[model samples]
Target chain A: MREVAVVGVGMTLFGKHTETIRELGEEAVWAALQDAGMSPKDVQVAYAGNALGRISGQEMVSGQMVLREVGITGIPITRIEDACASASFAFRESWLAIASGLYDVAMAVGYEKMTGATTAQIMEALAGASDTELEADLGITFPGVFAMVARRHMYQYGTTREQIAYVSVKNHDNGALNPRSQYQKRFSIEEVLASRPIASPLNLLDCCPISDGCAAAVLVAKDLAPRYTRKPVWVAASGQASGFFEPGSDVTVLKPTIAASQSAYKQAGLGPEDIDLAEVHDCFTIAEVLHTEDLGFAPKGEGGPFIMDGNTAIGGRIPINTSGGLLSKGHPVGATGLAQIVEIVEQLRGQSGHRQVQGARAGLAMCLGGFMHSDAGVVAVHILKA
Target chain B: MPETESTENSRIINEKWFTETPQGKALAGSRCRKCGRTYFPRKRVCVQCFEDGRMEDVALSRMGRLYTFTVAEAGPPGFTLPYAFGYVDLPEGVRVFSPLGGDFARLEIGAEMEMAIGPIRQDDGVDVIGYIFKPV
Candidate 1:
């Protein structure tokens, strides 16, 4: 296998976009090309990740549709659908393409347009992320599953609703600094605790908003990366794991995330202690706490205390979700994973203005897709060395 | 099913789910004969030991505690909003997500809970029979 480096990363400002999904894809790709000091002609192959809402399911072969805009039509393109981890998996595949010597340069894009779908349509599309035979049949939604985890964390650890609210409060503050962040507003812990309840412990303020945006990255061989950029974030490790289909795993402890992170750290010859910053999948507030613990930033079941104690704050022991994460950055499903990579790239390059972690040397990002049985259908983790 | 007997009334109907009495009969699941791994909805193969086609039918404990929960401010198609639901970690070590019966606060984490089949909600005039972890 060859050494892999992210030569360039770019994206459109994540928020409600009136532009078509194809246009967003083109914009993101153009930005990446510009960053890479290359053009549409440089990429050898392409992989795109796109998901459909209830009514948005009408569109088929999303990769072919978007790649047409950039005039890279002939290169083999694959459309990925890994729920929220769609683009993350796409990015992973692109990394593999470069690492496995399959391609010297590969284009990875993640695009989604939820502005066109109705609320019901969106919920129905989300249901597709679950097992069609069991959980979805029970009308279970993603928030519903996380909510159960939150409730369990509360009971087992006496983790307060305040700790969950603290996550939103902190992410909002981080999001406030990100110009590309979809959510520009900030929330107080009090505001989160008093917000209208969505399911139970999770309130309206606790949930991430639906977003429409796209992000893209261009990966090249490590030796060739210097030709494009002076600072290419080296891909230290990329690891993925899957979980049980039934809701059997302890929600209080995120097992799949731990295994995936551990595998990634081992592969990279690093540990959680070496990470200076991270962008974890925080689709919900509790998800962030669980992620911190699972990724070995904190001990098992002590995730709540970590948050309450402000250990994950930007200036604290380890800055997390520096891009506002999915909670405040806006979760566009298919594009979220690549978006994390893009943010890490920016932080590494010292391009992130206000949200940047000072002198960050290493970074980690994680994405989980699907929920059933005891596992998150899939877990993807990656480490980057500056 | 009458609304009183049913727990919810969501429109999407799934016939695969059926009511089970905890004390009456054991619900069918799969246990890895070699590795002792268990699966609800039962697996034909053991995932842990990588043993193919070696699972045997086993019964699971119906009792457990409420692990966590959330309410959907927005609901799925054919389902209503503000519904109570969460994951229940059974004594057999299986954590299942199900609707919570009665008040939302009663669905506390670590609260003693047991499985029951009841209406999920009313949808298009049909009551949905879904599983839940009601406070014991």
Candidate 2:
């Protein structure tokens, strides 16, 4: 397989968007094209990732319509949906297209218009991310699921509420530094702990909000990258895996993340030690803790103390979620995956002003979608190097 | 059956996967005869052996140990807020998500729980019968 590199990445501010979903997709796509110093004509193929487009009263084939509005037409356009990992999977597909010598230039775009719907409507749509047949009917939501994991983590590892709250405090602090983040105001640990409880052991601050936004990235063959940009973040590996129905030893651990990260590490020929920073799927405070451990950054059951010890902060050993993660950046679902990749690209290029990890050479982006059985239904992990 | 009877009988949510017996109502799951693996809500074929196994209906164990749990102060539409729920690991080796019955603070991991079937909530003027795990 040939090598692939991300030439340009672009995204709207991670917050509520009043524009139509098509316009949101267009803006991000145009920004990515401009950043790559290319035009619509340059894109050989395209993939759009969207999860709840129907919630917007749009057609199922919404990707093509969204791209067509951006003057990007006549290409083999396809829509990709993996819940929150929609755009990340789209990025993986675009990367594969280039790496497989299919297309020299490709684009991946992910968008979600969540704010257009009512809060109850939005909640119902997000609930669809879980197994409706087995889970949602039981009044199970993401917060409920993550709360169970957090409770188990606390019970098994002696993790404290203060330790988990620290993840929110730290991420909000970083989010304050990011202009694109949703919640710019820094939050205190007390503030997070005192927030409205969504589920026991997890307050509203512990959860990522229902946001509306979009993200896009332009990828090209490694050889053709220099023509578009000098600072090309090479796609080292893309690993994706599905969860098993079989019950595992512990519900605290996300088995699919561990499985996917192992494949990513093996493909990249690198381990956690080699990673300078990462933008993991911190949909909840507990999620960050779990992903850090599953990604091999911290030892099993040590993720709580790892964040409390400032190991995941920007200046820490392996800075995770310098983009404020989904916690503060706001989780727009479909667009979150590409948004993480876009952050990694910015950090790799040394363009992220306040949240930049100093002298970062390589970074990892982990995105997960849906809950199946006892774990994430699907998880996609990508390792990128400068 | 008449249409009126059918509609009333459909009070049981996910009827095919649930059944009533003389002893008690239990969740209906499938056990693969080939590898003896049990799955909740039944399965058409055994995922373990990848061959057509004689899947038989097996009433899941009515009692299990609470694996993990949480009390949701907020819930989706039609669900009463401040509801407590969690995953229960049954002796059948399948973990099921069910509403927790009894006091919220009293819930703990490794606690014994028994299955209870009744109206989970009222939907469209009909009681939605569902499963839950109650502290023993």
Each candidate's DockQ score against the native complex?
Answer: 0.51, 0.70
Instruction: Provide chain B's TM-score, model 2.
Output: 0.87
CA RMSD per model (angstroms): 3.5, 2.2
**DockQ for candidate 1:** 0.51
lDDT by residue for model 2 (A30-67), tens: 89999999988999999989999767667487788888
Superposed model 2: Cα runs more than 4 Å off? B1-10
**Candidate 1 CAPRI assessment class:** medium
lDDT of 1 at B24: 38
Model 2 chain A poorest ten-residue lDDT run = A244-253
Specify the CAPRI tier of model 2.
Answer: medium
Q: What digit string (tens of lDDT, one per residue) describes model 2 on residues B1-136?
A: 1211225633666778676666767889999888888888888888888657599889888999999999998877777778888899989788888888877777999999998776665576776777878988
lDDT of 1 by residue, B4-95 (tens): 24334343244323323446333356778898877766768776789988897777776778666666777776566667666677776666
